[model samples]
Target: MREATHDPATPLATGLSPAELRLLLSFAYTGAVAGPWPAVLEAAETSLRYQAWGLLTLCLDVFTRGLTPETGLDVLAFAVAYGLAQVGRVAEDYILATFPSVVATPAFLDLPAHLLIRLLRSDGLNVLHELEALEAASRWLMANGNGQEDLAKEVLSSVRFALMSGRELKKVPSVAAGVADPKVLRELMVESLAPMAQLPCRVRSLQEVLVVCGGDKLTANLAARKPSRHLWFAHRYLSAVGLVKRVEWRALGHFPDGPRFRHAVAVVGNILYVLGGKCYYGVRDTLASVYRYQPMDDSWERLASMTCGRSYFAAVALGDFIYALGGSSGEIYCTDTVECYDLTPAFPCPRRCQPLPMALCGHAACALDGTLYVSGGCDEACQCQASLLRYSPGEPAKLLAPMNGQRAGHIMEEAGGQLYVAGGLCQRDGQTGYRDQLAFEVYSPKLDIWVLLSPLPHAHVAGGAAVLGGELLVLGGYSHETYKDTHLIHAYQPGTRRWITRGTLPHAYTDFQACVLTVPPALQWVPPVVSGNPPPPGYMP
Candidate 1:
């Protein structure tokens, strides 16, 4: 028998071996641990079992950073056993994102049935076709379904058979009949033949959700417009009879304060940061207040305010900080001040950064390859700008080749490793007057050139843009030509080089911001209901 510590101050290690106790003590005092793979895992297990939270957290960090295709399934099992929700979520996401490749690994066959079902049930599962999901389920059953008939039925049922084509459906019985009850399989096959419009199963799952926040809409009675504090996100889409499709949008609660528009929004990790914007219609109502929405709790927290009030500005998250660039500061004209918030701090305050060379507003900005790129906005003189500028902290802005034409209130986003600028008011060449720009453009960083693409079917100004599932989406914005807000959503497909209508917002919303988020399960499972209920007459987006 080994002797125990006699000192009262020395904490006793009840469940840990001598090696694990040493590893834990070292991590406790130095915030780091090291050992062979087996010993490290043992330390992690002891840390969690003994409630050494700090050491456990460090272990999780190491595990997450070290995850690979071979070790990902093991991480999921460990996370589930230790109640490490965040780690489990990340591992599951990795597995789904690389499903095709991950499925080939031997570790995948060893995945427990409970975990397999959880992955299949997620809306975030990434698959090019329903057959892929069916294949995965079949493989799992062949490996693990030996005597677990009920479990086999549940796993097979998780695959969305309705989304599979007739040929794909035919293979289901051949693959699943050996494991699941033949009677149950027959009913599923019958159900899949019904018209897709009538079927309840969603056609596909989305890993990234598009969240539209804080835009203005015409109030009831049509007397005046009111800003909306409501936050909405599309969770699923249902297709009806030919050419008719509807989106399932649900509320993710509301923003803090009253309501805001002409503001800026950015997402770092899963946290949403809502920055300065006017709360009301007053020209001078610009806000410096900052708030963040935590999806973990569906809660909002007010962070340190910006140094200057701004609206019609651009915000982008880079590294550990969110940069708030040029916009109007409730002044007679826009301002060129720029600031950033260090997300590392609990109560992060804005830190001053090098200002833009000229005052600009209604512009669009995106961070690409660690550098900031700003394009197409109005200068202080109220003149639309065609210039593109590259900027970095503490350094003067560098001007690049200007766009083919001037624009403002447009959207700029990075997709497929390049930047795309579209939809804003643009000056017609040689004309003193300006019109809504239907023709969009793309910028190539390697060649440093801007090339015009096909024109949009309709124009959008002050619209929100986000990249979801590798597609560039332009959300609700009022048309400069018609001077009316639109609820329609347009997505640009790079493969076809065409713009396709994805769906519409619940309301005609403009001057808002949209970001792609991997919503927490709490918010994702909120029972999606079709919103767009006939707005009491005269409801403008």
Candidate 2:
């Protein structure tokens, strides 16, 4: 290979150490094609106090490889001071990706104000429980404020105190003690006392994840026992690096009432509205009872019942109302009737609305742009239908363009201003009759069109599905051959146009409902509290 000459006229060339100068010459010779340039740049800055623009450009090429964990913080400080925002952001991403390791390091509290603010504003910071973020913010302010109350207030403003638990908010002054301005502290206290709706810092949509509800399962002692059933809530958190972890299935206290399956769940604000479903296995007995679950307080309360019992229905929250569309009622396999529940405190009962033109069951529904879209369900005849339906508040449902394939027990969700349907049961060749479906399709309301995208890795039906972090997560369903529950969890990445297995559910489950819930700001992972004695001070739960 031909040797390349370094441009001595390059900025700060004279200040470069021998190692840095060699790397710089290589960068110049190869037109900045190199590996591990961040290491080279770090050495250059540490020894020679020089930042070669060429070397920085090379570093960008290997950004995806990530920075060494030990060097990430130092590089971030250097990047910020040099006004290399793009580089700083990459460094910050690395640091945040390994947040659990860095969170306890003293360097976390010593980060410059600008870098701290940038990390706090990131949606990826959801990896840190809100309380941890709060503590880090307080420590940083206390360390860097230097008795400047105004600067302390400015730094504190970036912390989402409204999302913290009421108990944590009460200790804010003690946590921030000598650094926080009394006036600002008083304002925070007053704000914490206000109703949750009025709080300025609520959980953002990206921080939310799908919570899977009750399902059926076979017990370990299978010889003489019937299949076991459960009424619990399953939740998981995705790391900043897109790895799903900490899958938990927690019981909603004891199910003194009964077990439910094939139900419908809708979230309006912080409350979960769980609607009707069958009470037992192989029993025609259905329910009209409704319950509201508040995760913040870990409490459940009974709500007004629907006009009639329903199961395998499509429910969606649009505006301030919850709409229950066509589904089976009692012995009837299907019903065309629709009902709307006014969520306003004055009228909590579900009232009859204009019925669907035809009955539907095992369908999916989602709200978008003040309209409700229903897709892929079996008709009253029990035949899979590809028909798509749209409904407005006072308007009767209208049929839109049919889907590319008939689907029932599929998943439908609205994302990026489009509607996506994936995995279901569809009629196959005459020899095969009906079979599980792997087909996927997208609909654009603006264009009035349907486009088939990549298919799922395998056929799935009755899976819990939701959009999290701008990707589609399909969890725990079954196929035709097995006829048993599946623990698989698959994620569809639009950028890659492929399906990747993210992680498995804690248990195999089917016939369950899933919806995203914004975690309470003050929620922590804490051990069980014993009676009488108070929890240890500052202990996270």
Candidate 3:
């Protein structure tokens, strides 16, 4: 028999052998929680230092019926620390809501300040009175936590708001976002009403609304700093829409001039990324530009003067380049030309790429590595296109296998290297025209064939699709009569062949485009190991 250590300070190896440790590692890695794990919980906690997530990780596999006392805190810490952000942040909520011993301070919040703040946020502050003591625990944490930490301030803010209602009903956006006060809100409303007698033609602008809305940093808001044309419309529109209980646009100053952005715009790396099309009139005509919005200063700058100014263009970003595919580029075809913009240098003017294989304008394009796959656009004949084409780097575009049917204005996504096509218009026999498609298709490069997958729950098209943490998210787009108002994000898991609905976006949009910039393979998942366990959970294909 092996002799035990005489010194209590010295590390003591439990009776479990190295072979048993190896077996526990195997169960944790594969999530094969069907059978019993031989080792006790203490052994697993010790391994967390080496595995870096040994405790919580094992718990994630066995969380429900699986959460042993040993693995609970570790799992919560692990999920919070890594920002284990998933679709709907389901994993995060599971950890916070289910953990039995997670209320401990400083150490329990193993996350960075920002993450800790997020974990504690709650909206609607309505909870059952039974859990009041547990809910009030947030106040204790805020008081005990360090003042220097932003998380402490954030938590204190939430506690203040939550205490008023005494509830834990909502998984709010984040505490760092600042909690609101009812008393402050009422005072702000009176102050906003103070300004209502001022501009008439200012009918609708963001400025009027901001001045009256009474946000936390109202003085520093865009309307107060450098007012835009929409500032006027913002106030008037809100009041007219009954959003503002009693407010008028006349309180704000003169509305500003031409073409100001009216949406949540962004500029990643360089390509001027804009969302939610807005119309700004010139002196003579009401012209709407495909506004290339700049995030640096929230400025709206036009790109390429747009051969045709139209919303709902199919946008696909690859490498550092953005290819604006088919939409109404005016004159029948969105010009069949793929407008490629180099986003790195943040070009003042966009440089157009050569036209696509042909003028199948308004098509969907999906990028895999450097090659772009284009499909489903209207052709010169004015018929919806279902022909598929592949565009490789430095190579001319060529047609590949066509979809099983004709679908223009469809949505495209990729999983497991196979392209997934969502709902759109599909015409059979060139007769009975259908506004929306109930079917979907998958294209396999190896097989060089198209296979039909499960049909969509509802009919829609031109929606935005993104693969986040391995789930292919297909969001809102144009439906039959009007642009779909719902963000309607759905996640497609190739493994289970399932489509699960997720949380909606901050604002619903069909005119906008969404491109998920994935961190390269090296950084996204784990680095290559010679031979060991499979990849981490939820890695993109």
Q: Which lDDT tens digits does candidate 2 get at residues 504-528?
A: 6657777776667765434433322
What is each predicted model's overall lDDT from 0 to 1? 0.79, 0.70, 0.46
Q: After superposition, which runs of candidate 1 have C-alpha atoms over 4 Å from their true positions?
A: 1-187, 191-204, 241-244, 429-432, 526-541
Best by TM-score: 1
- Expressed as tens digits, the lDDT of each residue in 81-173 for candidate 3 is 545544124444433432222333334444344544544443212122212323433444444454444433344443322122212223222
Judging by TM-score, tell me the better candidate of 2 and 3. Answer: 2
The full ranking of all candidates by lDDT, starting with the best, is 1, 2, 3
**How high is the lDDT of residue 164 in model 3?**
20
Error of 1 at 54 (Å): 36
- The TM-score that candidate 1 achieves is 0.66
- Per-prediction TM-score to the true structure, in the order listed: 0.66, 0.60, 0.46
The per-prediction tally of clashing pairs is: 1, 6, 22
Q: How many Å off is the CA of 426 in candidate 2? A: 0.9
Instruction: Please report the candidate that would top lDDT against the real structure.
Output: 1
